[model samples]
Target: MDVVFSDVKGMKEEQEQQISLVAERNNVSKENKFHKDEQRKERMLELFLRTKESILEGWRQW
Candidate 1:
C-alpha cells in the first residue's frame, strides 16, 4: 500500500511539472508574436513616410 501511494505521489508531481512547462512555453510564444507584430508595424510606418516624402518631392519638382 505504501509503495502504491508513493507511485501516485510521484506521478502527480510529474504532471504538475509538465503543466508548468507548457504554460511557460505559451507565454514565450505570445511574447515572440507580439515582438514580431511590433516590428512589422514599424516597417510599415517607415514605408509610408518614405512614400509620402517621395510624393512631396515630386510636387516640388513640378
Candidate 2:
C-alpha cells in the first residue's frame, strides 16, 4: 500500500510539471506571435509613409 501511494504521488508531480511546462510554452508562443504582428504593422506603415512622401514630392515638382 505504501509503494502504491508513492507511485501515485510521483505521477501527480510529473503531471503537474508537464502542465507547467506547457503553459510556459504557450505563453512564449503568444508573445512571439504578438511581436511578429507588431513588426509587420510597423513595416507596412513605413512603406505607406514612404509612398505618400514620394507622391507629394512629385506633385510639388509639378
Candidate 3:
C-alpha cells in the first residue's frame, strides 16, 4: 500500500508539471487544453483512490 501510495503521489506531481508546461506553450490560462488536462488528472486521481479502496476492502475481507 505504501508503494502504491508513493507511486500515485509521484504521478500526480509529474502530471501537474506537464499540465503547466502545456498551458505555457499554448499561451492561455483558461483554455480547453488546461481544462482537459485537469479533467484527466482528476479522473486519474479518482481511479487511484478507487484502487486503494479496493485493496483495503480486499484486505478486510481476508
Candidate 3 Cα errors over 4 Å, as ranges: 1-30
RMSD of each: 0.7, 0.8, 23.6
What is candidate 1's CA lDDT for residue 13? 100
Residue 47, candidate 3: C-alpha displacement in angstroms: 0.5
lDDT of 3 by residue, 5-41 (tens): 9999999999999999997877765587789999999
TM of each candidate vs. truth: 0.94, 0.93, 0.52
lDDT of 1 by residue, 1-62 (tens): 99999999999999999999999999999999999999999999999999999999999999
Q: Residue 1 deviation, candidate 3, in Å?
A: 79
lDDT scores of the candidates, listed in order: 1.00, 1.00, 0.94
User: Residue 35 CA error for candidate 1 (Å)?
Assistant: 0.4
Clashing pairs in 3: none
* Model 2 error, position 56 (Å): 0.8
Q: Candidate 1 local accuracy as lDDT? A: 1.00
| Candidate 3, poorest ten consecutive residues by summed lDDT | 25-34
TM-score of candidate 2 to 2 decimals:
0.93
Between the candidate structures 2 and 3, which one is better when assessed by lDDT?
A: 2
